[model samples]
Target chain A: MKTQKIIDLLDEFLGGERIKRTRREQAVLDLLDKLERKERKLLEKLAEPHDADEIRQLNLKLQVNRAHQEKARQALESWAKTGEAEKSDDGVAI
Target chain B: MPACWKSGHCLATAAAILAGAALVSAAAFDAAFARIAAGAAIFLFGMRFMEDGFAALTGGTLEHLLKRFTTGTLRSLLFGIVTTTLTQSSGLVSVVTISFLSAGLIDLAAGVGIVFGANIGTTTGAWLIAAFGLKVDIAAWAMPMLALGVILVMHPARGARGLGNILAGFGFLFLGISFMKDGFEAFHQAVDLSAVTAHGLSADLLFALLGVVATVVMQSSHATLLLLLAALASGQIGFEGALAVAVGANIGSTATAVIGSLGANIDGKRLAFAHLLFNTVTGGAVLAMLGPAERVVEALSAFIGIVDPTLKLALFHTLFNGLGVALLAPASSRIAALLIRLLPTPQAPGLTPRFLTPAAEAFPEALNQALRLELIRLYDNAVEIMAHGLHLHRRILFGAEPLESVVERNRDVVAIDLDSQYVERVESLSAAIVGAISRADAKPAEQAEILRTFQDACLDIVTAVKETKHLRPNLTLYVHHANADIRIPYNAMRLAVGNGLRAIDQLRKEPAEHRDTLELEALRVRFEQDDREMSGKIEAMIRDGRITPRMGMSLMNDLRYTRSIVRALAGIGRALFGEADATHGAAERVLGLSDDDISRLARGPS
Candidate 1:
């Protein structure tokens, strides 16, 4: 998720080093915050002595979260630098 | 065949009939039968006494002898003769050979040679009976021997007590022989085996059957041969019947090995069958050439200036056994091949432990060694799974490639179904170990204790695999985190486990004798040190404002996962590869986390 420090670090390149928050960036933060909370809660709920069947499920969740976090961080960094989020082949700024 | 009897009855019907015959025969040959039965009982008791003494005295040096000196078939054969002579138990010697053979300590040829030599060695009992038992006034001599033997047997020390047992066995054997001799002398007046001995093939076959029945019932060919010899010397049985009985005794001796090898490993079963085959074939050949064998025995008897019929029988016993060896020794390698073909290594579906075969469970040392070997396989599988869990391949960890490079290139996450792997490898192997241990005939509390430790070791490995499975997802997520604050800490955790595992893998490959638990304990200590450094790194990163309080909390929880993976692997290594194991009981405690130390560590966060 995009923390305040990350937002400021991005704004330094996007808005001439000024501390400003755009509506688009705010939406991004809100969505990222919600995702992070959901992932953390899910992780906490999945208890110990994880039996044979449950391990794969746990691994897939962690894998997707990690991949999503990395992709999101990259997009935010690019948006802060060039006033545009990175676009995928489908033209979605993910 | 009877409607009254049930299946799996063994020889219950035959035994009942034998018992009835003995009761019927008692009235006619009452005095002599009484002395012979009492003597045979005493003789059998002495054999057990001597066996216990030898075992207590020698400890585990027999394993060393099997490991080192058995370079060729001849040496192993000599070893068989010498050991059986000392212990007065061919069955014990044969079982030990089978144990060694199954464990791959000695090759199959060496094992075959030893069994053949044991056949020859067992004839020494017949010689003892003939030379000392029949001719000498054993009752008077035995009294002093029993007296001396009791005093020594009462001694507190191991070797001394063992010596006492040997002396006691000697005394009892002589006394038993005297009783049998007197019984035979008395019985000759009432009945003679010649009356029943038919001419030609029927005579040879009938008496051989008698020999087999007596041995099977008594469970001792030595006893059977001794009885036959005493009966022959006292004119109760003809020389031809004695010869047939001698052949039967050879065939009968294999029963012990055969019964023992049941439910044993493939190699053990093969060895036992080999034992049966050798004796059966030898007996057949001797019967085929009975006339020639008798003439040879008579010639040798005259050359040695021996007039006693019992002595001539002893000479015949040695010659026939020697003939068997001479016939089979050249084909020892071929016999091994034949045995292997007859009993191919079993191939159960899925995965089973290669080392924990029924043959390997023939004796305690072999059983323990096989268990250790299987546990090692479990560890190797675990290492592979753990490497995959951390987004790296086993090759990357075990190979010359840098661990960092491998982790970095692991951008394309490899999918590993840990559940399938566990089911196929760990679970199956663990169950096999438990089953093998449950079946292990390795006697006494110490052997059982070793197997228990192995079983516990298997549990530790399974638990280790399970822990790593739990840690996998978190390890994968954090190790490649977006922020350097989180990324660096997680990587450190991964590296800690990776390094420890790699170190242990190297240590595991070391010769079993040199691999020390202390070294494994040191690796574990370093794992703890790595944990402390990671905690400090996380704290410093938080203070620098690189990560939020929430991020720091996640790393803390994830760090515990990483720490656990390392701990489980360490636990496995300590159990499977401890150099100071009881097998090396004779050696001084060198270095390793002593049981107390490991217990303290297990108690948590010292």
Candidate 2:
């Protein structure tokens, strides 16, 4: 069978939800994954003793990753409940 | 001569000379002249098709081949010979050399070595024509080749089309040689060229000049050589005169390199000059020893069993070019150093456009490459200006020392006229880039997108420079302020911008294959975090009586400008370095966060 036909059959088997996730939602999930990994890494690094400056920058990066993680989680929840893409309020694509 | 040629009127001069020749030829000998002209046209067209076909077939392997193989003088020389022998066009090799040199892929020494090798490599065409084109009924082969070529030309595959074009090109080239041979034979029966042609060195000199004009007009030394070979085979020209014409053709071939380098940087110009120098010196040496050279060619031809005069002419071509390379190859490094000394990069008041040239603008892909190169130049200049404005040295900013230490050490204000610097360094180049973009031809949808991204990047760089200018005055004023609270935030702002610059610099330096857009996007998030922290610090300082209301207001405004500068730099970086690969670019666009996304994220679950 053709790849598209196979994908269609799979989608049908999965109740049409498998391939229907918006790219934005998937992207947000990817971003959340990266942020969470970064947060864990930062926590591990912070566990070791270091100078005050390195500690401060690491903490700042950790806080930023957590903040983005929180927003991505919220966006993911909204998408799940509404089945509609959550739009960025500013509409600026990086 | 190069200066006059680069003044942009050489094309007009060449065209006028060609027009005069055409008028005189037509007025003097009409039908035979038409045959020769048509033959030359077909030959040149064949070369064009072949060049285009090879370019398409090779895609980018030619560049990689040139880059990989052109390591030393001997290697570069061999690469030039092998590639030109395969392509049958020294001009194509020269243009590729210039393009790579302009892009800084290969150094000038390698470029000169390649040029030297190409001189000998181009001689193979003459040999091919003499051995096959003159000895046999080549037009018989041309007919079948053309039929097969047309069949393959209709194929949908690019490789098939490229192969088709190569076959068709050979067919046309063979046909053109046959036509020219027949035309010259008919003309020889009507009137003897030997009778009218001057004798001795004067005749040789005149024929050599004719060779130069023909090659320049046709823009193909192979065409000129094929015509000379046909004339020689038809008894329309003597062997010595034909040798002179070959010498002239070698010299005239440098015109292609000259034109190619017009769009290149100084190293490219140096390479073009080296090409001209090699050909001219060799031509001059050959002419000065024409009698001895002819005797040597004859002796070499007899030894090699080349009984035909056309074959002898081909031997003469190879011998002379080989002689040139043998004499010049050893000194390739010294010649490159000399060229560097002779043509130092001009110290213009402002950074000029290096890659935006009329030659580059002729093709969409070249124009896009040129624009990207020029935009990178603009980005570099803007970075320099912005670094100076922030009272920091670029070397220190882009160094290994911690950003906090770098900012702390570079506390003393550096005096600079930001407006003048902007105008001199950034504005002129920006204007040139915008003008080149506007003048660029309408492109395909994908290329049009690249141009748009380039345009946005240009704007981002200019805006970043302007923001640096706006933030400079207050930075220089209050960076060393008495109040620690005010000074610390300002220092923190410097550290932020510096860290962003350093990170982008590292990313830019990384190879394209290893580039990570996700990392850059994460850096964007990190920058947002820094900006928010600055905002919070300013608010707290104002409320806790650490800083006055006016100071806090100033702090807020400068914080905004700092954020703008940082964002602009990151945007420029992403536009230039982040989109290196299509897959990565698409993924970055899809997954990258926006300002609003970051803002909402900063609100902690809201």
Candidate 3:
């Protein structure tokens, strides 16, 4: 529903900060895949309230992951609105 | 003498002289000796100036090349060869390699690789002298070189000055060789080197020993090389004698490097040892194959259409060094590992000052160097104590663990016992510095004042550590207090003090020339500002029922103590560094706190 140019998408995500990756990282980045995966139970633990130090640590990591996810989503949304794609991790574009 | 002994030839000349000194005219001998001595001095000055010029002209291109090319052992070897060949000084190459290794710019294997190649590179100087100096009318070239050198020296640019020095060095090198050649040729006109040559192991040992002694006395191998080559060219000594002298010269060349490394770190010593080992092993291997090596040289010389024995000796010089590289360079890593075992760490695990030796107290410069080192030691101890007083681990403080997390981890431990650490690490060295300066032989007043200023810096460090002792009790109590009002201010103090310690530790590592004292000044200003803000915060807390009046009073006193501690540390900011330009105290303009800044902080609201 948004009308944006291809250049705007590239500027938002790829200006100044370049990943300069190859096709392998680009493929994973295009699909918005997490870099690594673990048991869903670790994610389940992160939803609980911070009651202990370990819980606090888990909360901190999830906060970092959440921030990363938000950034990635913003980059993808800009690309969807326009014809251009941000530099993917491996530098491939879909 | 090391050169003569190594060559197994110079002793015969000495004996022949002892036999014939009564026959020779005293004036003639004295004149010949004078020319040789003067030539050596000129040659040495030229060599030194040339090195200085090269260093200035290259800027840091040589360093860059060393960094870029020394990625692997083989690459480092080639880079070393090229750098040393261009520089014409193996000692210079060794110094560069050692410095690079110390800076963590290159790995040990790479440094060792360059060193092996440098040994081979030094032989090029011999080639220059033997192939050209012996054959040509050297004075013809020397005059023009000196003329060009003077012209370049007249230029205002630093690069031109450096080029001029290089030209002058070239001129002197040839001129000295010519003088030495004439002196040897003059001696040969009356006497023969043939009378001294014994064809056995004893002859070999004698020449090698002579070479070592001559190098030691002269404190230079290149000078000794010039003398040896001059003798060889004039047939004052035979090929066999030159070979032995070459071996000795290699061994004797290590002395200056070893002496230079006296106050340096284990890495520096290790590099020196590596140099010594390479030369000795190579020299030993050549001695082992001396007869066969000679025949090989003779065959090679015949093949190359060479008639001059001097050129033949130059070929041998190149061959033996190349042989050493061939044999040892492949095992450089093994040699480095062996060196590490040979010269293990001097101290086990704790902080110790290396520069506070008896010799340091013998001269103003040495005393100054020692004092600088002791102050650095004091700084390191202060950092350790200050960092731990904030309940932060030493490793984590300087590690990847975020400073916030490091500061936050002080839930249960107050690990700082300041008095004992001060006694153990600071007091003895501080006392030694004072003692050394007092005993230093008749130092000039300006240098004495500089030492006094460093002594004052040591006092500031001790006082700062003492303040940490007082701050520690409050620091632990207030950091995790139930009251947010008190805890937040206390935590801020911890961060400020911790950051101060980190900055000082960093500045200690940086050279005096490169320090941005303005950044430190800004930080000091911020610390002063923090005191004003902290006082306001404490008053606000008392009004807000966040802390009682009694608690506020205690907090205020502690805050004042915090101010005192920071001021004490900042007090030495200039004194520790201000002594560089001792005569005019010009270093005072750039280093540490000015008197006004120190007084302002001292008189600030507490």
Candidate 4:
């Protein structure tokens, strides 16, 4: 209740209210989670390929999965090595 | 005049005589009437400039505040009071609330609460005038303020100009009060208004009527209260008569809100009606209990301390408005429901603009926000049509079910007239949005750019719908084809589009902090690869004689259309849900993956 009162006071006086950017890293985390899930889903679909046509579709989807996963992994590595990557590249991290 | 009403010449002659008589009376009391008239004019003018200046300075800050704070009825009531007291114009608060209502930003209950609080908030103006305006030689202050205001008004910064206008507004208000006080004192010397003051209930009712008329003509309760203060200060009107007039002024202020609602939506109308209901009921109840109310006021004044009559009048204003809020606030929800039942939303056509209203257009911030929300509404409609054209149930498409099974289950083409639906739903709304944007006066360059982006989103949505129309026939024919080769690819296309729709829908629902438009951009890159792979596969099939060239050609064309549809949908998503902050959005755009980068990642683990 005390915290809420402080927030309300700030909100009243603050001219342009915006969501805080303290949680900017959350976008990277969410994307990593989503990419992992997509990779798993693609692997499951490719687990029992019946024909070349089906294999090709699975291959293309796997390629997409790998492309995104690789980008997200690189982003995660850069964030861990130096937080500068996260600060500078919102779109790339995601 | 009554006898001559039927004949034009007689009416004209009667009007001339009445005009002459009024001129003679005005000449007799010219000093008093002229001062009063000039003062009222200046006050109203200052109020207008101040409202405009605040609006210009705040931009969309007020809208954001309203959205963030008005979470409940009580909160909204407090918000209305604070904003109105700070701005010194209940009309500004009322108009902003109505605009929010028309834009569907705040609900009717919250709006009713705000209007209730505004009534109480507006009483603070009377207190300011009574406590300070009557005591000071405010015209002395007006000169310096007006001089400084003119200098700042010439400044290029909007903030400076806003401050200048506010300063000038206070100056003019003080000067107007000074003029009014002088006018009433001089008028009292020439003519004894006390001799005309009648006693009893009839006189009270008559004074209340006079108050209502004065407020209605000026469209400002504060002005009416000031006029009453001047009269009472100079013994032009009795204390009892001033109280009745204050009650009437409260009721009359609702007329401004009603006039503002004329261009608003049903919800705006409901809010306006709620304002009228609260004031009228409070006014009527106060009228019935005027005798007891006066005694209570006198006792409260005595208990507080010995007070001047003007200060006592200010207390009465606050007390009565507070009484109204106490009486109506608890019943605000009931009043909202009653308003809703009284003003049912008209059954609009499928393509009618929900968020676009003339009232919203009056405020540029409201206009831009309304147009964006309307575009979102249009996108929702387009999504429905596109889902149907793909023979997918929107309920299933947007549900938690896997799209692979969902697409297979919805293979049988639903009977739908794509052309008619597109024209009626998508095309008409798209046209309306474009027309509104074109007709809108984009004064701020930032608003113009935002509007242009919305215009682009509209085009992308329309393109997606058109591509769906083109892809539907081949999709419906080949999804269940006997040939495994053709049928499997067709199903792949269907699954791809369904997955795209679901991703964009989820992105739309994702919280701001978690949302990432780069994902959509990445999807666009993936769709490009899919188009290439499909083209190559179709070419190989045709060369191998697994499928006829005609079949291969149809598959190629449909594949291209499917890719177009996906790309268009992704474009719409990126435009709508991009980073809200301009700097952050620019960084995001710059950091977005280009086609070559996607290719390098897709080729291998390197």
Give candidate 1's error at residue B218 in angstroms.
Answer: 1.5
TM-score values for chain B across all models: 0.47, 0.47, 0.45, 0.48
Which residue window of length 10 is worst by lDDT in model 2 chain B? B1-10
Per-residue lDDT of B166-204 in model 1, one digit per residue for the tens?
A: 678667766765665565564443333445657577789
How do the residues B70-185 of candidate 2 rate in per-residue lDDT, one tens digit apiece?
Answer: 87889999989997887676876786676455433467899999989998888888888888893235568778878888888889876687678877866776676555555455
How do the residues B164-188 of candidate 3 rate in per-residue lDDT, one tens digit apiece?
8778767766675465445444444
**TM-score of chain A for each candidate?**
0.54, 0.64, 0.44, 0.56
Q: Give the docking tier of candidate 1.
A: incorrect
Candidate 1 collision pairs = B264-B358, B264-B359, B265-B358, B265-B359, B518-B592
Candidate with the larger lDDT of 1 and 4: 4
Model 1 regions lying over 4 Å from their true place: A1-94, B1-60, B96-107, B134-195, B349-606
Best by DockQ: 2
Off by over 4 Å in 4: A1-94, B1-63, B135-196, B349-606
List the global CA lDDT of all models: 0.65, 0.72, 0.63, 0.71
Is 2 or 4 the stronger prediction by DockQ?
2
Q: Which lDDT tens digits does candidate 4 get at residues B1-606?
A: 111221224334433554454456568867666666665555545544544444334323344466567877789889989988886767657866775554344678899999998988888999999988742345788788888877887788766886787677666655654565555554333322234488679988887887777676655677678778888998888888889989988888888688656645567778888888888899888988999999999999999994799999999989998998998898888989998889876543548788888887777667767877888888888888888777787999999987778877666445355665676688777888898889888754445766776788899889888988888766666665567778777887877778778888899798986675656655555566666777778888889888889779888888878777777776677667776643344334334455676666445456
lDDT of 1 at A68: 40
The CAPRI class of candidate 2 is incorrect
TM-score of chain B of 3: 0.45
